[model samples]
Target chain A: MRFDVVGLGVSTVDLIFTVDELPGREVVQRAGESVIAGGGPVATALVTLARLGAATSMLDSIGSDFFGSFIQREFTAEGVDTGGLVVAQGRTTSKASILVRKSDGARAITFSPGDAPELTPDEVRVDIIRASKILHLNGRHWDACLHAARLAKEAGVLVSFDGGAHRYTNQHLSILPQVDICIAAHDYAAAFAGTEDVAQAAKALLEAGPCVVVVTQGAAGSRVFSKDGLDFQQQAHRVDRVVDTTGAGDAYHGAFLYGLARGFSLEASASFASAVAALNTRALGGRAALPSLAETEMFLQHPL
Target chain B: MRFDVVGLGVSTVDLIFTVDELPGREVVQRAGESVIAGGGPVATALVTLARLGAATSMLDSIGSDFFGSFIQREFTAEGVDTGGLVVAQGRTTSKASILVRKSDGARAITFSPGDAPELTPDEVRVDIIRASKILHLNGRHWDACLHAARLAKEAGVLVSFDGGAHRYTNQHLSILPQVDICIAAHDYAAAFAGTEDVAQAAKALLEAGPCVVVVTQGAAGSRVFSKDGLDFQQQAHRVDRVVDTTGAGDAYHGAFLYGLARGFSLEASASFASAVAALNTRALGGRAALPSLAETEMFLQHPL
Candidate 1:
């Protein structure tokens, strides 16, 4: 099936539990309840996009284990195309256990990516990228990701990299030049640019290779830099209750990609993305709390 | 095959991540490493029994999901018989995601038990319980557990219940009469006895029907009560480091059961269990850091 955007990276099974309060040393607290869901940056972003009425596809590998099947089923349920997903033998897919404190939306996470299967360039379906308007990646699988980005560029498709961190070695840095737009956490941007200021970090990042660079500064909002100069600073929509910040960044990326694919201007798209992200923090986990298009628009018109 | 002990309860796949410190608000920390292994009370106990050279079998249900398969694989790999395990159709099994804070071995856990399959008395192979010297239940399956306890009692097998919590309404009170030995946490004992003092809680629990009652008091050690009157108190072994307390209780229960199966005296078993538990807290997770028989014996001799 053809897609507007396809995401490539890890997908995981998340175990979430809620506690009344975080206890001190030697103190025990009773957990209220628990839930299981699909998690991971690219996977969650794709789910967010699909929920926002975008035709999304996920290209990743999962183990043949129970959590792997859980992830596959969730993707199917979310109406995401899993045609590109490969089930590996002799390994269990990634899993995360998250503890949410009730007083605040703070969470403690533990995860196991049990020998995550590697995807090579040969496995990248050129036709899929060729048909897509944008190819989004989450900064893993550097070699294959570079190949995919190269293929997308050749196919006249825009490529965006969700630079979560700089775990990539010098070898992986070679792929940065092929990326068109780079979006990342402020810390990641600072680390990449070797500067602490968001504006300076954004400029350094754009100079690194990408035509445009965006640094998300949590509640301080976001800043974008391009050759055309800095765009207007967008403030985050004030949220009444911050239930969770688990997938706020993923929501922003997904909504931004959705806006870009739908022909929205850079400023408008960033504002729209920020609204969706703020709305997501009102609930638990990442994807479960994503707002609908109507909700996002309403939030923009009459924000909390 | 004839067995020395049989465990009936829920088995889980644990996703464990170890971080250098507790993450602050909006702060992200890199994980040092991660490990995936089998978890849950009965699951760990059976694995411990198998490791201690006892023939063991786990009677439980798992979801047909990927996580279930992971749990099954772990049990089989550990040499615990899986013949009695039923895979529930169209159900996702229980999973736990745990974060181990490196600074203090403290852990935050999130768990999801999706449509846990139930084991019925009719599904029990009579000979398996009859041939066993002890039958252990973790109070996960209330009705089925009660039935199994009755069957074991009728066949002259000693029945033990690992009362993790007071989950089964008032119905669990009925099963208490059939239980020969009750091992539980201080909180659970308090809830069951309607009091906070561990010694008083044990006395009240003993009156509820079990011939013996043991209540673990975390770092304070444990209190034991019996029909023959209260036995000696067992103190917690001093450890230089306490890594993650995630499965320390389960380790204590497992080692305590192992001692009972080996015909150790009540006082000796409690001491052995305390030593094993202290050694387990020396690392992280349940089965991942389990001490060997020799290691536990040495710790018991050295008293730390």
Candidate 2:
């Protein structure tokens, strides 16, 4: 199937419990507003891309379980193609119980990865990768991701990646050479570079091979470091109020990916993505306040 | 404010996700049926008691949050008194995300204790605890539980306890001397006794000061030990099949407490409680298949 962006990763069902603060052991708090929705860096980004008028498709082994059903249904509802998806038998989809602090809208998440079968390299649909303009990835299903990256590279398709807190060091970093554009959360860059400084982290990440590396610092906006020595920074859009920042980073990555597919310049896409991220904080989850292309354009016209 | 039983502990909001098996790290499975209910050792017991036509009330710090509101609303709906409940400011309610295995009905639970304020001795409603015919305790809110037990003792009310797993050894063992009737799951008895044998566990628990100790063994019914040297076994009620056993033990405790209040003999109460536990396993959650007193009595007549 022809596609604009094809994403590969686990789509999690996030059960967000809102509380005043994260509790210590043995402490009990009454939960405030609770939300249940599909979440995961690549999953949310794919949803974001679809929302912004991209013909996106998702490729992952969503187990034949309730959570898998929910993710697959949600993907279809969000206009993401499910033709390339695989349903593994007798497996559970990832479920993340996130505790969102009411005051700062910060969160602590407990992730339960169900025993779904791993997506193998053989499962990578060559035709889907070749037909797709962008093959987006999050560092899960390492072998499958590596295989898809290789196919996308051979097919001359742009290999976009969302380096979200990329903890699987060697596995994730090695795939960077095949990645064309990697928009990462600041923490992911910091971890990848083993440095606290954002600039240094971005520079270190660029050295590892993604030609264009963009590091997103929440509320501080985003910065892009290109191998061609083009460095640009975009200011964050002012938010009227922040309700929940749970999925804002992924929204930024999704919007940024959307921009690249739409053929926008680096600086323009960064600012456009920043606008999308800021507006997303007005709602409870990552997909709650996702703006359309026109809405994002309008948001860019007037800051908040 | 007179009541048949007063319970002291949390009314946890349980999010049960059904999977084929317990997941290992980083695996994903598809979920099957999912259920949400107010559950806890004492809470389920109270719910069972209320369903069986007992005049029940509960005392705890169920904060003014969504889950707390849900529990309080459920209590009011179930005809359980909530007049003595405290709405602690800025606290989150206990949420248990349980993964129920579809194949064997086994479950693995991840409990998140939100930062709700602890219920203190001062918050224990002296009048409510005294007015109740029986006081039920679960090993949470240690100070408040101890205070309520003392009040029940002074008022000559029967103090019945449900020693869940009783992992809090030091805090739990001390509460036993103040307890009158103790009904515990086999696991709790084993933990209390630090032995694998059910008889030894029951005997060991009785020595800690509960005059009556009954240990519930799932599918095997129960064995009761009395300080007066009466030890008797009750056969489990045979069911067509067991669906969910989540709160079967609690149902047994609540039924046993009901039997005593209704003036039944020790042996008769054990059998009656066994009937309640057996019947409760026919549905999705603890409260779903809870039988009315008439239904339970009918089951007792048929012995199933």
Candidate 3:
């Protein structure tokens, strides 16, 4: 089946713990509650796209163990196509344990990818890439992502890369030439651009060959630089209570991709994505409280 | 159909996360890994008992939710009897999200018991309680526990209570009179006994009428006090690395009961339980790394 957007990367089940205070050494304190949900940059992004009425597909490898099955279950339940998912025999899939502090929407996360197989270029389905309008990459499987990005570029599809962190080895940077949109965190932008300033960081990243560069600043909003030399700044919608900011970035990235596919201007897309991300911080998890298009519009009209 | 130990309480699926540091305001960090396993004090204790080759039965309420079925699946797979387990409609079984810190063996735990029905006294199977040599009460359903404990006592069966925390309330405390062995954490003992010192806590708790009181001091050791002035202290086996301490206490409780049923002395039983708990810390979850009797004996001999 054809897809609006196809996300290729790792997917995981996140175990979140909400705590009243940071526990002291050798002391036991009770937490408020715990929740389990689907997580991972590409996984959450695809789920968000699906929630936004987009036909999304994910290509990745999950363990054949129970947690792997859980990832698949969440994907299918969320209406994200899992046809491209590979269940490997030796691993147990990736899992993250997240601790959310009650006072603020802050978190400490730990993850283990037990036997998570690395996807190769040979595993990419050429037909699926040709069918998709946009290809989303998280740089998890470098070789596969590079191959897919090149194929998508050649097929006249837009390629968006979510550079989680800039500390990746020089080998990962080699795939940047095929990227059409390079969205990154402030740290990644700074590391790639060699400048700590947000504006300078975006400029440096753009010089790396992307047609558009966007650097996300948590709670501060986002800065976008387009191919036509259009620079715009979008402020984050104010949230009354920030519960957990675990997947805010993923939401922003997914929403941005959706907006771009629907022909929204870069400025409008960033604003819309920022608003959706702000709403996500109102609750625990990255995808739990994702606002619908109607909800997002209403929120824009009467924002908190 | 007879059982050595009958556990009366709730069973849950535990989602455990291990974090590098405690969470702070407006920050995000990745977790190390997530581990899923069977949870709930009595439920886990029963699993431990079954793993140790004891005939164990669980009498509790699980919802008709997916997680509830998952709990039952794990229980049956582990050879624990679930004939008395009640599946309530429109309710989800309990779930626990636990956060473990990397620097220390500290945890923050949260739980959700969605629509889990409380077992009424009428639901107690008198024959089941009478057939068991030890009736283990987790204080989840006070009324049901009281009724079953009374029946077990009348049948000359030893009744053991695992006092989790102050949440059990005074109504549950009233059931203490019918208990033969009362095992509790130091915090639980202080809340129930109104004393902080372990020895004083045990002394004050023994006065509450349970024939024997065992107070667990995390990592320090455990103390057992009897009304007849018999007292003994068992040091915890030194653990080189503690991956997750989620089910250490439950393992100790289960092993203690097993030792008691096997006609071991109080000191020997506590020592055995300490070894079990130490070994449990060497792995993840309460039941995953539970050592066999032979394994425990060798561990104790090696003294690591």
Q: Which of the numbered candidates is closest to the native, going by highest lDDT? A: 3
By DockQ, the candidates rank as: 3, 1, 2
What digit string (tens of lDDT, one per residue) describes model 1 on residues A1-304? 6788988888987777776654323333445666677888898889888888999888887888767778888899898889888888877788765767777666656566767567778877777888788999966766678889899888888998897854534554676787788888887877777788888887777777788788888889888777578566888888898877888888889999998899998898899999988888876677777888888888889976
> Per-residue lDDT for A100 in model 1?
76
Using TM-score as the measure, the top candidate is 3
For candidate 2, chain B by itself scores a TM value of 0.93
DockQ of 3: 0.36
Q: What is the lDDT of residue B175 in candidate 3?
A: 84
Candidate 3 scores an iRMS of 3.7
TM-score for chain B in model 3 = 0.94
- Cα displacement (angstroms), candidate 3, residue A284, comes to 2.0
Q: How would you order the candidates by lDDT, starting with the best?
A: 3, 2, 1
For each candidate in the order shown, give its overall lDDT on alpha carbons.
0.79, 0.82, 0.82
Off by over 4 Å in 3: A165-169, A196-207, A238-242, A265-268, A297-304, B12-34, B62-70, B87-117, B122-127, B154-157, B163-173, B184-246, B259-278, B294-304
TM-score of chain B of each: 0.93, 0.93, 0.94
Residue B41 CA displacement from its true place in model 1, Å = 2.9
Ranking by TM-score: 3, 1, 2
**True A-B contacts kept by model 2:** 0.01
In the range A59-107, model 3's lDDT, one tens digit per residue, is 9988987788788888889899888888888678887766666776456
